[model samples]
Target: MSADNAAVNFSELVNKNKQTLARLKESPRLLLHRRDGEDLVLTTAAKAEQDQTVVSAASRMLSAMARREPGSMELLLDILPEAFPWVRFLPEPDVHAFAVELVDTMRAADSIGNNASVAQMLTAWQHTAEVHSDPVLLAALTQDHGTDYGPVRHP
Candidate 1:
């Protein structure tokens, strides 16, 4: 993110060995632009560790807040709409469910250092919202197929 010596070509690693390493050391990070596929980041191992530690601590704190104070979850529920516009398609109850599941999953993933689990959870929730967004699908799913004539029981 720093402006000075921020990026360098992948080929520079081999061509300018000494210079690239020096730049890596001086700058906080160096973006290694690649022609074939995804770009790579070059930074000190210490910096990477520090970033992970901070993220894990924040995740734990948020999880604890939701568990100890039920009302704290309302704040995260409110932001879901802004963070992901598609959530508005889902009903209010479903949004609350998503917020609870998200915090729990985030805490577990952080504990294990498994980022993929958190990403997968978000993808699943987004897919659920996508289904709700389709009116025809919702109607088909709710349509009554004549079966038992049981009386409705009130909770």
Candidate 2:
């Protein structure tokens, strides 16, 4: 499900607290935009728990499917692009790899009720897709570099 949120300036929370909260009657979450630091989200406890429950259950189900199906990645390959449009930029094999790792990471993170790593993983993969989408950057990145470079070794 899509996140039901309304974005408002952080000052709104301090100045128009009542009006801001009233917005929550329509949207379950308030994304407070901050100028100085990271933005914060204001959400009801019920919404938070509901989101967690959904994530936890989906992660578990995907994990079980992964374990039960040897060709799970192939199955995921069909859906990954729909969920993450940028996955189309990756090679078929790498897309499968990304899907497998993403599902695994989601299962692990949601199992613990902490999604920091899940967010991190998604950002990293999206960046990877971005780089791959740029032919110049992809060629430059895959070019032979110095010894002991990341993902490359001196033969």
Residues 34-128 of candidate 1: C-alpha lDDT, one tens digit per residue:
99989888888998899889989888987988887767888788888998898999899999998888888989899789778888989998988
Q: What is the C-alpha RMSD of each candidate to the true structure, in Å?
A: 7.7, 4.4
Stretches > 4 Å off in candidate 2: 1-4, 146-155
lDDT, residue 15, model 1: 96
lDDT of 2 by residue, 26-115 (tens): 998889999999999999999999989988999898888877877875777778889899998988777877877888899889878998
| lDDT score for candidate 2 against the true structure | 0.87
Pairs with steric clashes in candidate 1: none
Report the error of model 1 at residue 52, Å.
Answer: 0.5
Give per-model TM-scores: 0.70, 0.80
- Best TM-score goes to which candidate? 2
Candidate 1 error regions (>4 Å): 1-5, 127-155
